[model samples]
Target chain A: MTDPVAQPETAIIVLGCPEVPVQQALALYVASGLRERGTDVLVTGNPSVLGLLKVSDPKSVYIGKTLVLETCIGEIVERKRDCTLCIVFAHNDAGIAYAATMCHLLPKSRVVVVVFGKDPEPLAAEINFPCETITEKAVHNPAQLKTKITRVLGWAVSRT
Target chain B: MGCIENLKYEKILPLGASFKECREYVEKNYPEVWYVEPGYKLFDEYIIGLPPIALGIENGEKITFPYTKPCHGTYLLRIEGKEEVERVRKTAKTKKQAGYR
Candidate 1:
């Protein structure tokens, strides 16, 4: 008998508040990288952030599935949703809380916290849980974050 | 008794408890309550504030959430009653309105 086709691994990219200028760009970059690696990507965020992403990727090039932040959390809490990888883009206390919650809920999934903002060190320090973390002080320029993301995802840094 | 400042009975988790701790506490103590996180859309508005997590009990009429003040700490507050719950729900957008499939 022929074996059934296996589903592709899934990765969830949870975004924080959109006030930070680099979050959207980095989120797209990470999603694209994950997709290129044969993993399905779902991006979750607030209305403002989702709206920005929607307008930015009108053709659904980078982001595949999009879910509201609360809905995604609720699904995770209820065990209705699961993924192979979870990446949280954090720049504030709330982002840390979200990442911690993800860690607690998805014990089996690999969780990575990407910390950025005016002061990422302090914000990254607030994470007391066990998870991979990448911190870089960035706002308008996403190069630092991009490099860190490439390293975390095992993608080669683009020369261009 | 005149309208004076006073205290009321409520369950408060330990100070400096993280959102994960608070969620676990509520889930263990009040398993029947609905777990809610930040950015949850109520009626027309979203739950956006400090601490970023909450519990809904009594069919969501009472919302137990963490409130943090600068230099103070995080405290769990339960607001009971249909009026208040309805107020928050009305301000939040529903899943349909939020374009959730």
Candidate 2:
């Protein structure tokens, strides 16, 4: 019998509220980087965040597929959907909560949390789970976060 | 009694109580209730205090979860009714759904 072809890995990028300026830019950058690695990427967020992302990438060049945040969580909870890797972009306590929740839900999958804002250290400290966490203090400029994300992508690729 | 605006009943946690503290409280006080872990997005608006962590009972008929308002604080809301419970249950992984065997 012939050897079966392996399926590409899948990744879900969970985004927090769209108010933070760096979130949208970092999300797109990460999605693009993941896509370049031949991984299936899905960016999920609230309607407002989705609207902003869609408007930014109207042609869906960087963002391949998008799902509503609640719907995505529902699917995971019901064991209807899953991914090889889950990345959460967080800036506040709520973001930390979301990341912690994702860790519980996807115990088998690798979860990476990208914490950024005025005080990323304190917010990142709130996460008390087993996952790769990246922290940077970037509000309007995506440079710092972008570099950290690039390193994360490299590390992720090396592992898988 | 005057008209009840909603069917939901709530008990707000004391100030400075963390999510872990709230979960411990539920486990100690309401041992029969099973809780979904923190991080489930139960509300439409962005939660500023904590992620929506809920405790389910009565075969998913009655649920008590934490709901936080920006600058207001978090509340342990006890909502009765199967429909609402189902809605909350669908948002995050539960004990059974988490493959507790």
Candidate 3:
């Protein structure tokens, strides 16, 4: 018998920093949306963000695979894993660097950078990649981030 | 980092392009640059500053430390030299690979 075709995977690199609630919410929200679309989602993040995700999504309904920041890079650089979609949450300069690095490693992946906070345009510009971007000032409000994520995901769904 | 304190260190601001390019730029000019991967736990704690680049320096006698920032648009500790530049690329690569943090 012939083997079944494997589902294309989607990787979300939820770049987070200390004291960023909006970023955490957005990451989870986007991951959940991607999961609903029948995409195999891999959520990569730091300890604090992962911890919050675990508490928020204890059932693993939204996020089934949680990887450390290193493993994510290893997947692309070492194992040569490619993704149908790669989302990067960039709120600060460091976040932008991480986004750039991922884009650099996975040249074939469709990478998108999400930016939020005061005057996000400047930061968005810093990403220095030719990919889709979502920028907003939703630092204080998780709801806004959720809305933005939904809209972005809607666009992504239509594209595929 | 604390482990390589015995060597002189410097910061290579704005790694720009890919890690390979950054490394090549530094090595072609500065032949003394070597890389030291930071432990995972240590890396995780430090990258919170969001530093674009950092590096350790060894001037044949003493080694400097590696450091990073959590934010942007601030005064970076001024550093110079090819070794410093290489250090920045190595540090950024390690952090990018989750080898540092």
TM-score of chain A of each: 0.91, 0.90, 0.83
lDDT order, best first, reads 1, 2, 3
Worst 10 residues of 2 chain B by lDDT: B43-52
What's the C-alpha lDDT at position A4 in model 3?
A: 29
Q: Give the alpha carbon lDDT tens digit for every residue of A1-160 in model 2.
A: 3332232399999988877899988899888878876899999877888889999999999988999876677778778889998999887665666677678788898889999888899778777688999999899999977877766567334534
TM-score of each: 0.64, 0.70, 0.62
Report the lDDT tens digits of candidate 3 across residue range B1-101: 23323434344435223333343444343334444332221222222222233333334433222232223321222233555344355544442222221
Greater TM-score among 1 and 3 belongs to 1
Candidate 1 docking class: incorrect
Q: Would you give the TM-score of chain B in model 3?
A: 0.30
For candidate 3 chain A, which ten residues in a row score worst on lDDT? Answer: A1-10
Best by TM-score: 2
The prediction achieving the highest DockQ against the true structure is 2
Instruction: Between candidates 1 and 3, name the one with more favorable DockQ.
Output: 3
Give one digit per residue, the lDDT tens place, for model 3 in A1-160.
Answer: 3332233466665565646568777777777767876788888876767877889889998777887765566556554566877888777665665676666666787777888776678787665566778888777787766766566556434544
What are the TM values for chain B, all candidates?
A: 0.50, 0.53, 0.30
Full candidate order by TM-score, most accurate first = 2, 1, 3
Question: Which run of 10 residues does model 1 chain A get worst, by summed lDDT?
Answer: A1-10
TM-score of candidate 2 to 2 decimals: 0.70
